[model samples]
Target: MASTSSNKSRCATCGKNIGTFTCRGCSQDFCLSHAQEHRQLLGKQMDEDVILMHDQFQQCLNEQVKQPSLHPLMKEINEWEKQSIEKIQLVAQVARQKVLNIISKHTDNVIIALTSIKEQLSRARDDDDFFESDINEWKENLEKLKTDLNTPKAITIKFDDKMNSFIPKISVHKERPITERFERFLGDIQIEENGQLITHGNSNAHATVRGKGEYSSGQRLFRFKIENKRTS
Candidate 1:
């Protein structure tokens, strides 16, 4: 009977004797001696698989702490900063050229007027036939010309206070309403009123506009009001 019972069940590892203990997790039967060996093997596997993975994750965490700028999001922010600076430089270059051109033209006009006054004074001085009334009139004209030369009425510098900055602002939000403004547009579209208002610029053609924000998922809502319409 003992021989028959021992032969009926065999150890999973040794496969020669009856299996006394069965692992509830693996469902494999083992003899008393091999059961302890199987538990030891499981312990070794836990160290190799679980604890080793944890150590590897810890190393990644340490690297993140040392160099936060290595993140992908940081790279995107850096790119945005670089592009914003380039835009500012481009606008400044155009503005500088415009102001310089205006100043040159204004100076040429002033010099032309001054030359006319100079010729009159020179002719009168040589002739020596000018009266006090003529002298007072010439003096008054000279003073007016001097004032015009110092301060040209045509040159005016203005800043748009509604535009807080030439570069648009960015922020992070959790389900909060995001502000979207028109960025790039084609055809005859005009962005006005601090970027909140959009108006059609031309009556002849159609206009298309692209917004600043992009969304992959989530419900979004947009609102617009038609303030006025062009007649004809």
Candidate 2:
């Protein structure tokens, strides 16, 4: 009876006796012409809705990329990394200069000493008669040179082969770890209608508002005051 009764339903749009199809959403019957018109109207509404959604989403993404309020930790950490690297570079430069200075000083001393020994040997060769005093002096000089060879000459800068192993081997970089943490947090932060956070299973996140009262998405997603920071 329900099926037979439904067959006799009137078109809601044209008020005609025969209906080609029934709309489940509005729960209304419509004639063929009205049904087609209704479908076209719905299709237009859907297109408009899709376009609006795409525009809003694109705007949101653009705002986040171009002018987002950068995280304080991220900025601070980047600065820290730059400063630390600069400091290390300065220290390395100082160390390198010191090494060069020591090498120059020690090399000059050794060269002068060798030159004096050479001159004394030439004089000894010229004088065939070996004076007892000269023989003793040359022997003493030779012994001194042998001792100098054993004595540590300004610690030669040979890097410890094992030093590389002792340096810190971090599995994750400083900013990289923070970025990974934020990436995981990204999944939890869902901006809902009117700039609200949507909470799902195990998500207990909250958005902090600074410098003012509550904001509503009237025209844009929310309202906020933007000011240029001035440094004195």
Candidate 3:
């Protein structure tokens, strides 16, 4: 009889007395009066739990679906971005090529222009040499004329008034002895401050000599001594 009472004290679901009912679906037990109500409450709670679980499962599935759908769109967007970058690079390359071509053309034109200018400059330099030669020839002719004009000479000529009008008026010459002329021409020869000998005389009697340390041949020398002449 004591074993029977002890067995009746056990819970119906888990067969242990934990002092409360637990639903079967949720692994809970109930007393005699609350058994039916507990079963009904458990059935209602199981239905609500199943609906909640289904909602969670459907949410997970919807998230998975959205992830797959977004993957293709993301791939398309990335591909479009890559394509746009490549197109931009291609356009930049073309523009760079065009700029380089223009620069090359400009450089070529500059080179050609410089070549032409160089050619013109060469021609001008050649012409300058020709002019220089002409100037040198003229200078030599002038030196020769100067030497001839300075030569001492005596001439007897009747001058007409018309010829005198065209001719330059010059002072009459004072005759001196040849020795006296020579002495006068040589008397004033002196070494200047710059160590160059300076002679003061008529154009035909002028003479000069460089200093003792400096001398060269072909330097200017003149003599204006006349021979004996009877008084007219």
Candidate 4:
């Protein structure tokens, strides 16, 4: 009976004799010596597997820290900033060009008027026919030219207050409609407090002071508080 039983069962590893134990997990039978060796081999393999997985996880973490992906919204905001600045710069350039052109035209017109006056004065002096009236007229023309050169009433800056925009729109106007209540004035008048107030001097007692604006058709109301007045 003993010989028959021994022949019926054999060691899984060495196959030298009948297996003394069977593993519950793998369902493999092993002799006593082979069972201990199989347990050691499984423990070694478990350690190697743990080490490999740990290394892989660490590599993944390092990669994540080194090269993080930028958010989509961040890229979008950057592009918006670039485009907005470019647009602002372009508008600024255009404004500068317009101002230059206006200044050039104004200077050219002044020069032409000055040249005509100079020719008239030279001819009158050469012929010795210049009267007091001619001298007075030349003086008046020169004074008007000086005033026009100093104050460029044609150039007006407008701002769009109706629209709600990230950047406000500013425009330069050559012949804009007179919108403000008091913008242009003639005589010894001074504009103060950003055109909110006007002061007149009695430099010419007989000369009439006139405040004027070009309007096709409109009913306008004006209110003024006299800060100071001179009765001479």
Candidate 5:
């Protein structure tokens, strides 16, 4: 009777108790047919997982391959940007130098012209002073001559031995013309420096007498040339 009862309690497929036959691999209790089916399902699930892992690994490798190719291009672009910046800076520096050079030249020319004018003005003042002194001396000499002529002295004066007649003669003439004296003064004038003289306007021809022995005939011609150039 116990054997009969045990037989009735076992699974029909595997001839074992329904709960006693458990698969160690899957940790599930089942009849033989159901166990076999469960193993098949597990194997299929593992295959799907392996395929998914292989696909993911392939994707990672593809990404790595693309990165190596792109890296050199990115580096080249960065290097080009650096070189472009350097070239722009160099061009700007060259332009700045050119502007500075032009300004320096302009300033130098202005200084030279100003110095020339200043020197010419100084010479003109000296010439004026010399002319004034000469005129004063000439006046003093004329006054002395007048005083000597007015003095009265009685004496027997004979024009000819037969005719006893006295005649008073007076003559007045400039010992030296002012124009000729001025020209002589201009000729005596000299320039200390080795620069040509420049005149301002066409009002009058004024001699620029620098000092004692520094005047030149070329300076006089240069002044005339300046006047003509300005008028033209």
Candidate 6:
């Protein structure tokens, strides 16, 4: 017991006869008073490290809020969308106008024919012997009615939707009126948080995104990649 006590280190700061504690970090032996001082100094260093990390986190969050409203890729996407919608609108308008014109032509012809038939039927109902004298004429009028009923239905409006050829394809089809036949959409669209996208319209498409922090300026840099997509 005497040998073990004598071999132990003495206080580093206080030059005491014996030391009760040894610092784990620096391997320095100290009396009670000096040991407490060392612990407080280590704690201060740890607190400084924590505060530095906290400040970095807060700065990153603030930069997100201050980010620009439009990125280069975003602008490109907006232009693409605008052009696509305009094309769709033009096609729809042409189809609508054509269908209306056909309907108008048929309506006018049908009304004139029906009005003539109504006059003949009214005269026959007033005079019971009218058909008896002009049975052949009545038969001719009935044959004309049959001809009108058998008019050829040649014109029709059809919807054909297509999607971009890039990484994700967006295919749109003409949906029939909401009747019993619920025509399903032909394509799908999927987007990820990191700017990756996948879609299928007429075919498959994909996109990728990359981002980095500009350390010197505290700004963000972004890049986008697209594949197999046609803008319009």
Q: Which candidate's TM-score is highest?
A: 4
Q: How badly does each model clash, as a count of residue pairs?
A: 0, 0, 4, 0, 5, 17
What is the TM-score (0 to 1) of candidate 1? 0.42
Count of backbone collisions in candidate 5:
5
Candidates 1 and 5: which is better by lDDT? 1
Off by over 4 Å in 4: 1-79, 176-232
Which has the better lDDT: candidate 2, or candidate 3? Answer: 2
Which regions in candidate 3 have their CA more than 4 angstroms from the true location? 1-74, 129-232
Assess each prediction's global lDDT (C-alpha) against the native. Answer: 0.76, 0.59, 0.51, 0.76, 0.50, 0.59
Ranking by TM-score: 4, 1, 6, 2, 3, 5
Error of 1 at 142 (Å): 4.2
The CA lDDT at 227 in model 3 is: 31
Off by over 4 Å in 2: 1-60, 63-75, 128-152, 156-232
lDDT of 5 by residue, 46-157 (tens): 8789878898988878876877655667789989889977876775576566545554554564566556555655776677544665556545645644453343111122
Candidate 5 stretches with Cα past 4 Å from truth are 1-78, 126-232
Candidate 3, 1-232: lDDT as tens digits:
1123344445564555534444546564555556676677768987899888999989878887878755667889989889977876775676566545555554564566556655655776787644775457546655654453343122112334555564332222222212212222244354443432344443444464432322265453444433342233
Task: Give RMSD (Å) of candidate 1 vs. truth.
Answer: 21.6
Per-residue alpha-carbon lDDT of candidate 6 for residues 1-232, written as tens digits (9 for 90 to 100) = 1124667777788887464588877888877788888889888987788877888878876765676446556779989999988876776677777656665666676678778877877887788646554667767766765665455243443433344434332222232221121122223544444323444454444433222222355443333445776765
**Between prediction 3 and prediction 5, which has the larger lDDT?**
3
lDDT of candidate model 2 versus the reference: 0.59
lDDT of model 1, residue 58 = 94
RMSD of 6: 29.8
Give Cα distance to truth, residue 119, candidate 6, Å: 1.8
Question: Which scores greater on TM-score, model 1 or model 6?
Answer: 1
TM-score of 6: 0.32
Q: How do all models score by TM-score?
A: 0.42, 0.30, 0.24, 0.44, 0.24, 0.32
